[model samples]
Target: MSSRLLKICLIFIAFLFFSCSSSDDSTPSEPDRSYEDVKTDFQAIDFQTGVNDVSIRDINGVLRFFRVIIPEGDLSSNLRPLVMTLHGASGGNPDAHKNTGCFAEEGFAAINPIIISPNGGNLDWIEFANQVLVLSLFDLAINYLPVDDTKVVVNGYSNGGNGAWFYGETQPTVVTASIPMASSYNTFNTAGEARRIDVPMYVIHGENDELFPLQRTQNWVEATRSAGTEITLEVAPGLTHNEPCNYVDHVKNAAIWLENDVWD
Candidate 1:
């Protein structure tokens, strides 16, 4: 062969090898669990009504914490909806699980969905790193558990409420709706996230919240509503920042709104 033809053959071989390698490369599904290990954990789930502690290592090698609430029933039911409950500013998922029992219980009034609370720790919802970790965890749950990806409800309080708004804005197509309580619009994109909510959003704020003042939330809510997004703000009569349990009834209302109005 001539030198030119020989060079052509080498170039084609290199191109083919690179194409195949790029096509085959993929990120690991989870940090620790193998495919068989995932199967084992899925099978080992108690499937009873209780809270279980779970952790997943993100691509950054950080251990993300989560508390999952399993419902009382057989696991053979059709794919179930998932309620992601985000805690406030600190203590991560444990703070949410212990103090917000009223929320997990009454928030799902009629629809018994799998409840998961992720620990925010040092990262806030607005950060790209946190979004990656959270979305990875979410993908893991949907893959291993019987989760219906279509009907996802993200509810949050304080900083997590800000996260609720962030996800609703970022994952509008996947998230069915959001119920944010006592969340400040001044957080997570500086509440710029509130302006981009395409999915239905129902906000619950105390009339007398000292943290992240109610008026700021109201201001953003009004602005967002002017843009024609479907949003409802429910102002609790006399609730305060510290009393999360008091918002159970409000969350119950948001649940009814989801079942009767939104979750078609």
Candidate 2:
């Protein structure tokens, strides 16, 4: 073959390989489990009325979540709202349920996205890669489970609180409301990139919080509101960073905000 023709063919082959790789990245990859497998395994659990710790995968082959479904046994139901609840820096999926029992009892399905434990990934919530993993988990849940897409909510506590802020700001289209408890990000000027999230948000932080303090939540509320978003901040006085009552009220207020609150 002529030298010119050989170079052209090589270029074409490279282009084809690059295009295929790009396409693969955008598409949602299927999990190792089949639909029947998911059903069979799900049925084995007590879906009648408690949290189900389930796992789903992303396109890049990471096992990333536990779905907390509040089941209403034997009843033929359609799509239901979902709350994606994330845990703090101290623990993983186990503590997520133990901490947010109110959401499970209220019959709202939640997916507790498993943060990469043991720390290679950043503890900070704003990383785009982490956001992508969480979003992929949501996509997986929508397909594998009976969930209403429009009614999806995102929430977290402590480190997870920061994660909630990160996800809400980064992927606004998938998240309807954001509720963060105990911990919050830096000021809007520093973390204001997420201020574009105009979704209804409820932020609760303890006034005496030693770990994350009230100032972070205050800054988040102020920044979001300044950016023309609807955000509510509740400071629980005399409550420490780990107070149970603060969490109780956080859940209560979150549910209300998700239902009646409107965004600009």
State which candidate has the highest TM-score. 1
- The candidate that achieves the highest lDDT relative to the unseen native structure: 1
Residues 1-264 of candidate 1: C-alpha lDDT, one tens digit per residue: 334224333333222111001122343433443434433554565545677765544433455556777677776667778888878877443344455485766767577888887777766876766665455445545656777777788888888788898788667655778888899864224645535468899999999999878899998888777777788999999999988888988898888888888976
Model 2: lDDT to the true structure? 0.54
Residues 1-264 of candidate 2 have per-residue lDDT tens digits of 334224333333222111111112344454444434433443454433454554443334544434455546432356666677666764333334354554323322222222111111333445544554455445544544556666667777678777777767655666777777776675355533645465677777888999876776686678667778777887877888775444565566566656666421
Q: Candidate 1 clashing pairs?
A: none
What TM-score would each prediction reach against the true structure? 0.76, 0.66
Which lDDT value does model 2 have at 152? 68
Clashing pairs in 2: none
RMSD of each: 11.4, 11.4
